[model samples]
Target: MPVTGADVRRIALALPGVVERASYGTPGWRVSDKLFARLHEQDGVLVRLGAIDEPELREVLTDAWRARAPKRLVAELAEPDG
Candidate 1:
């Protein structure tokens, strides 16, 4: 089963070094304020993952990335951090 947003938030935050916050209406995961990932709304066991490097992960996870923001947002996320 896919991980739930709340679980993701709790686990990511409780991990050795991960922080969680609100971003785009979902839980944001960061390491030292750098956004590495985020979660989407889920019902039952389906959920999405989004991030600045989403495209790179998309190739690995294939359709699973859809649980995140639309494909176009990937480019926006690709922008260099400022």
Candidate 2:
């Protein structure tokens, strides 16, 4: 099945300090208010991830979150989940 905005939202929100906001009138995901992913036309989303799986998408979102989040926040993410 094709990925949906809800799927993206679910994975992105799991990351440290990620939130959903509006971007160009569509749903966008951000870390510390820094945009990492936005949902737009099918083409736009596909351009970012060409046929990606859930695990891969999670990795991608985590990497994006790590890049945009504050140093301290990223460090917090490094700690193992209890």
Candidate 3:
């Protein structure tokens, strides 16, 4: 299925400290109050990830989250599972 705003919302919100809010008059996801993803008025979801695959979506969201998340939070993500 083609990716949609809901997909973006779901994936973005899964990351730590992610929040949903309005950005550029559309739905947006943020970490530390910094916008990481938003629904474009005409382009649907915008992350510049080219194809709309789930893995790419997750990667973009995670990278954006890491960039805006606190150091401690990012560090926790880097920790290997026990």
Candidate 4:
């Protein structure tokens, strides 16, 4: 089964010091008042992974988009200059 918002909330809140709060009218997870994850209006869930190098970040993001995003969006994102 696909993961749901409830599942994300449960997992996020299980972490020490993590809290559930509103971000731009949507559910977000934070630690020490710093946002870590949010349910985006158009993109579903967004998670902040800090301080990654560009190449590695691109690879990780591309893999994630390929797995979850619509094929059209993934293709657009996968373009050489995108």
The candidate that achieves the highest TM-score relative to the unseen native structure:
2
- Across residues 1-82, which tens digit of lDDT does each residue of candidate 2 receive? 5556678888888888888999999988888889987777755443354477777788888887888999988888888970
- Cα lDDT of model 4 by residue, 1-82, tens digit: 3455665666666444557899999987666566766676473324333334444544543453345445565555556764
Candidates in order, TM-scores: namely 0.41, 0.82, 0.79, 0.52
Per-residue C-alpha lDDT of model 3 across residues 1-82, encoded as one tens digit per residue: 4666778888888777788999878888888888877777566535543457788778878887887888977877777840
Better of 2 and 3 by lDDT: 2
User: Which number leads on lDDT?
Assistant: 2
Off by over 4 Å in 2: 42-50
The runs of at least 3 residues in candidate 3 whose Cα sits more than 4 Å from the true structure, single-residue gaps closed, are: 43-50, 80-82
Model 4: ten consecutive residues of lowest lDDT: 43-52
Error of 3 at 65 (Å): 1.4
Count of backbone clashes, every candidate in sequence: 1, 0, 0, 0
Q: What C-alpha lDDT, on a 0 to 100 scale, does residue 11 get in candidate 2? A: 86
User: Where is model 4 more than 4 Å wrong at Cα?
Assistant: 44-82
Q: List the residue pairs that clash in candidate 3.
A: none
lDDT for 63 in candidate 3 is: 85
Candidate 2, pairs of clashing residues? none
lDDT of each: 0.48, 0.79, 0.77, 0.57
